[model samples]
Target: MTTLAEEVLAGSRLALARLLTLIENEDPQGEAALDRLFPHSGRAHWIGVTGSPGAGKSSLVNRLAQAFRRPADGSPPRTVAIVAVDPSSPFTGGALLGDRVRMRDLSGDPGVFIRSMASRGALGGLARTTPAVVQALDSAGFDIILIETVGAGQSEVEIARLAHTVLVVEAPGMGDDIQAIKAGILEIADILVLNKADLPGAENALRTLRAMLELGRPPHEETAESLPVVWRPPLVPTIATQNEGIAELLGHIQAHAAYLRQSGGWQVRDRSRLQTQLEELLQTALLKRWRSSLPEGQYQQILTDLQARRISPYQALHSLLGEPPLPQSIQRGSTALFNA
Candidate 1:
């Protein structure tokens, strides 16, 4: 009998979809399959497309998918898997799946697979199960995996930790000149895309982005001891609606990939991403173990004491951990307060 992981490895699309659903739901079977598929992972190029709402990220992803599937340079087409993370519907807890609708053209292409995911109230513009899903897609033989984040703003820079290359898309007339400085999102960009370039104020937006890049550029003096070489984010203007600049953007993506390989940054990023996943898993497991070990109603009692101001939160934590008791002064106050 062929296992689901074996089926996915053999290019079974139905098995792949079922595996992804199980992974998103955090099923144990999915984890077992992922364990088996782990060795086959890490072969795909992870590109993240992220930006504020209304920046045309979905259209950009659609165009990028097409470009990869049918390369202009006459290179053999690459298999592309797109993970579009959408804001969850509050009422139904389901993804709106707007990207699936916009990317209708790529539906019939066997070389392309698109999955839409709900954000599920997770912060940083990505769902909690995203890394696992990407891993599954990677092991399933996709050459390029594009993770399109939920419409996000400044603080949603978590994509940087996951993607080998991150494209921070922008648009004209968004007052992005100021937002660029205030928002840390631009800092993570390997490529800065000014989409909707056909719109008015496009030039101004482009110029502002260029200036920002220049300002953030690291010194590259060779004669003297210079700072480590940094990959400055290239600002590319595009009208995603028209499919213009898609080729150039694709070139930039390829260039970044090549640079990472040459500079050994590829391994660095992969290690960092793995480390993050490990730490997150460790934290979750530890919390779960700690919760299960607690005496029945002990945590609730602490919360009651905390509410009544009988014990400070720090003391409560100590009590929970079986740490040293609070000072006599504090204990007296706690008792009196509790009695009162």
Candidate 2:
């Protein structure tokens, strides 16, 4: 283990922040530390919050975090981690990372750690390094880790695959009734939230979401034979700024967490997350080796052929794979492009 990793496990917030920065920058050493720290992970509950841009998700997260840290809940004080993703430049693919300003109130609490990350133009409403960042926090002994996505509309359901529990927030008056509760976003919601519930048209939004949920699944039926039980997501209304429904929202979150543990879903989700992490790392390593082995001029010619549709991609791959290895001076793998 690196000295930094030891410090992070020892509860040094500065060391944890430094490690996260390394992962954010895609430093190779960051990956090595994650590998060393993997055994210490699988301890934190991963929660993801996603919604449209104006859904009051920031306030909602802040309130929920405070509730998690509250000692009056009959449990000891627990540590929490927050990762807020914000959009960055399209040209440079950098992030503005202004989400921290909204969460500044949570600063300076030794039990809370909030990180603002740039989306870096990733289409999933999350930074590419988010999983690694979550792993870092998990290894550092955080109890609950909440991730707030960029809220870039329906295509941003990447949280479903990344988090153990996903809270999908919606605000009234954002769109037409039917258009507001699109199937794409609803399918991924483990808990649906109707934020801004004090605003006009809140009832209509609630009704629309309720009706949509009714139409979404077949209700449980008593059968002659025993059947499996399934979880149905409940929609909770909240006015975050006023702290309305915050306790109820958290109650649902805790119920979902308990359900996951009781149903063995936690282990299943952890396996899925680890599989994704392994595949991503393997893809990076393979791509790096492939680029390193390419004998210069040969790759550009392939790109030109691909652009002109003069040759199929499979044909190009086959040709490249059939080619001899890079010259000995290159010091890369000495085998052929795709074969020994």
Candidate 2, residue 134: the lDDT equals: 93
lDDT of 2: 0.87
Candidate 1, clashing residue pairs? none
Judge candidate 1 against the unseen true structure and give its global Cα lDDT, from 0 to 1: 0.92
Q: Model 1, 95-212: lDDT tens per residue?
A: 6678888898898899999998989989899999999999999999999999999887888898999999999999998885777678778899999999999999998888888988
Best by lDDT: 1
Per-model CA lDDT versus the true structure = 0.92, 0.87
Once superposed on the true structure, which residue ranges of model 1 sit more than 4 Å away at CA?
Answer: 90-92, 221-228, 325-340
Q: Give the CA lDDT, 0 to 100, for residue 282 in model 2.
A: 95
> Which lDDT tens digits does candidate 2 get at residues 182-263?
5488788899999999999999999999988887766775333333245688999999989899999998898899878877
Worst 10 residues of 2 by lDDT: 221-230
Q: Give me the displacement of residue 64 in model 2, in angstroms.
A: 0.6
- State the displacement of the C-alpha of residue 1, model 1, in Å, after optimal TM-score superposition: 1.0
RMSD of 2: 7.7
The clash count of every prediction, one per candidate, is: 0, 0
